[model samples]
Target: MNGTMPRSSLATTADVAVRRTVGSVTTPAPTTTPLRLPGVMDAEGRVDESRLRMHIFKNGGVSPTERGLVWRFLFGMYPCSSTALERPLLQEQLAVRYQVMKRKWQQMLPDSIRLRLNGTDAELVEAVRYFDQRQAHAQQQDQQEEVRDKLAFLELQAQVLFERVTFDLEELQEAIRIIDKDVPRTDRDLDYYLGEGSGNLLVLRNILITYAAFHPEVSYAQGMNDLCSRFLEVMDSEVDTFWSFSCYMEKFSKDFTADGLHRKIELEAALLKELDPQLYAHLVTDNMESFTFCHRWLLLGFQREFEHSDALRLFEILSCDHLELISQQVERARYQERLASKHSIVPEDNLLTEPQAINTDFTFELFICATILLENRESLLRCRNDVQLIQFTSSLQGTLDLNFTLKKAEEHFYNYCKRSAWDYMNGHCRTRKNKDEHFLYQLRSFFS
Candidate 1:
């Protein structure tokens, strides 16, 4: 997150001026070799994450062998600053924590079964006695007092676990029910998850259950099975997949909520208005401004729109947030330059006066959505209503061109940056303090 891009690395004013002559914004194809292990890692074992992200952005993606490790960094399973020595220790810690959380939910199952089967107290006691016998066998030589102390400790621990289960049981049961239904249905056509009895499907279920059990605030959602499947496919290990999926959910868990999804849809509509006003107007006329047709695309990270492998590639690309990161660095450098210049006139706008907020808007995803729409602008325009629009978009399943769409999205992002720089230079920047608005502002100026 804290890396510098040489000024020459990004598109410049001259490039923007020449954009018209060139017909469209075009990024130079990456010349450096794609980063691999050992090279991506320094002698100290710290990853140059910014460089890795930029490489993915420029080169499309990494080899499958490289992707698992790269995604570990991108999704924050391992910090960019953590050394190789620290990661093993960190993994051990996470593994222990994961097991502890997993047991919390698992321990409730006996009680759950008792309730479901209407078992008598005597039967429940028999079940508890079986586990106690194992503990007694392990501690046969312990003094009577020591054994009593251990029993007391166990009683206290059970009380705590009981309280947690009592509070969360209803919600957790509902989450598990939904997850059971969704897991088998998620990406079953793919070779990795193809069979009804795929072990990977079980791994996917455990990760989602663990996530739901612990994160009650955002508990299991329908789309999470798809998201977790992607991580499990790459990471493979159950512990690793759970931790990585949790890290990713830290940022995106809100997307599963009604409010969060509405906000994203609104942002997409606002962006479409800027990028293609005529199309936006047509949707509005047809009362389709909600843009619900693309809801699955956004929710699942376009998992259904592209072929399986390409969708995996696209997920990592979106995770990198390279454009937003670069724009943040550029803004920081410009802010510094302005402060250093004695003759500089600071604007009254909050954008100039206040400290810049961390950029978490994930605008690149919206830009990619806009790129998809604009790519099909003619076809979309020909549709007279929302039903036709949804049908046309649905028919594009596994048919969109990944490379072409990605390149166009990158261009749109670069053009957005250039246009924002132009607006800021001309004293036209609004007093508002959101980075997403800046993206929309730039698109407005670019189209104008």
Candidate 2:
């Protein structure tokens, strides 16, 4: 999708009108490497004017396009209007920049997403101001094609140099061991790490804190520290670590949502029932009809289900987008259909909420989680006692066949999608609006 809108200069996909959400502000495909900062503003008051500079510093650097937005907004080429403009703390030029920033972000997204970002009854200025710099630091750089080519070249050159050097695997391995072991897992309870991008552990903590507001219930789960650490361990840069983790969370969202987790468990159980009804019956015989223990597995993402090192490896592989489970999930759609039955589901004008469907992309996280469990299903089936079950899942640590698992999941996803209809996940982009519209319609009963 081109960032530039045609005709009226504004995207008309119903994403306008407070529809564009912060969460939907996704990093497009790989592009040039300009500069990127870790996460946005810290607990301290360190942001200066000129969004260009702020984003460049925050994200470590900016992509040409993002940089263009930064500069355009800052200089006043783009006006945010009341809808986009958060406030008028600065002169028109600066105020417009803030406006353009929120307006651009709010564009092409659902109104419900915007509401979630602003919450209820908060002034537009206050909300816009918050978003203006929230990602000022985390802004990922997706420069033009030429820049990307050059950056790729340099990376290749660096890779060659790395190969030429006498690298120490054992030493690096030792470092990983020590770092993974030493980092305090308790950082989950902390709101933010004042230390800032000091290392993988701290970087992980920072991302968690930054997103805590977006996902309040998930807050800071223990295993997330491990996930962040592994991402940094592989990505090397804190920015990359956060981006990768954020991407990972896209799929793993169900595990974190309150009350929804039970739905996840039910879906997982349903899939298992479909695939192996015999096993479902077996579990039911054991008083495991509720699928409780598996909650931690889905929630922490196998951190408790497997060894630390193994969990790290599995997550890293899943994060790489190289698994089949990513495509082959029926549970999400099944669950969405279930949600509709509760009457909480709504129909929206223009949007496709009349009958909700799961987005195929939503399957990505479920695929990873499913792949992890499906790979160990053979062993999982044999276990009788809870300890043995945990032990058996834990045993599936490092032996996961990454490629095979992803391929299988993809095969399942593609096939299932063909059998199903509509994009399940993306369809509900304006979920809040759907709910609101439905509620308001209900209120008209007073007139009746």
Candidate 3:
């Protein structure tokens, strides 16, 4: 609604060439031309990010073979603007950084423990030989009293080491413990994570622990294992997976915090109220206002709602935020137009404005959530309490129609924009901080 062309208006001739009708509503025909190998890369081997993102959104997702390289761009492992010549250097730098951080946590353990966990057979054998030789020497010297004193000193050394361990280190160790327990259970049904000895599982544990070590602020959380495992599956390299996961967390890390999560819930609730007042009212009456069931959905990006492959597709699509990017571009264009008009200047046709940060407040993910609710409006309406609502949502796991849901969500977004424009033109829009007042302002300005 920020002066952007409505979805219907933005549709191209090709989009309209094939139409689909659903229950009296006709929409653009779905088309897919996912970017493949050379298509994603320019002559210089730099990514065409805008094109890649659009392809993912329009085509649903890239093919399984291309997902890894495509995700590298999407998650910031390779910057869209970086050339092939620059990428290898960048990869080396990142790999070094990953190892440095990995070692930082690894070195925190006592030598024996560290060697046992990360050492090779030769190193472990050398450690054993060193200890045995020292014990033999002590026995041959017949220094019974000295040996007893040495044992006491060793015990005291351990006690001091324990006492000297930083609070942060203890916290990290606890996070590692939890991550160890969770890694085995993550995506276990998949062949990649099928066994206790799965190398993929080890990689998953390392990334999570390293993430925890570096990001003490939002150290390992319960659901992070699910998130990390997905990245590991796509990006087989340990360093690439860690960095890509870290980049992803930059945007979504807030989702793991209390206030950030509460704000999202409020926004979701506001959206539902705007989209369907009756449904919101019914939920309020049933003391389901918290929308707690949505926690997992938002936290894991609805990873559990669909099968593994579909969830990957959904994550990449959501990460694209294609609609939101379009909205931002529209807003920027309007701003440029206003300046041109004020200064009596002619705007250049090819001038580009600086990129704007994405507004997370009104992301397309919320629309997807709204679409799911409206799709099941009748069933949700019948539920009178939170438990029933939770059960109903839980039962929806792995049963969603991804294509249908995406199409419907897109429709909802277009409709919302149209409604916002209409409300602004009619002078009925009001601004309130918690209730999309800023968005209404943008709408009014866009129309003005």
Q: Give the poorly placed runs of model 2, Cα more than 4 Å off.
A: 1-183, 186-199, 210-218, 239-254, 300-378, 410-448
Model 1: per-residue Cα lDDT over 78-195, one tens digit each: 7778765556545543443455556557776544311222144343334344434533554453335543454344334334433433326788788887877786567766677543
Alpha-carbon lDDT, every model: 0.65, 0.41, 0.65
True lDDT of residue 258, candidate 1: 91
Judging by TM-score, tell me the better candidate of 1 and 3. Answer: 1
Please report, as a residue range, the 10-residue window in candidate 1 with the lowest summed lDDT: 15-24
TM-score of 3: 0.69
Q: All candidates' TM-scores?
A: 0.70, 0.38, 0.69
Query: After superposition on all CA atoms, how large is the RMSD of candidate 1?
Result: 15.6
On lDDT, who's better, 2 or 3? 3
**Best prediction by lDDT:** 3
Ranking by lDDT: 3, 1, 2
Q: For candidate 3, list the clashing residue pairs, or say none.
A: none
Q: What's the residue-level lDDT of 144 in candidate 2?
A: 60
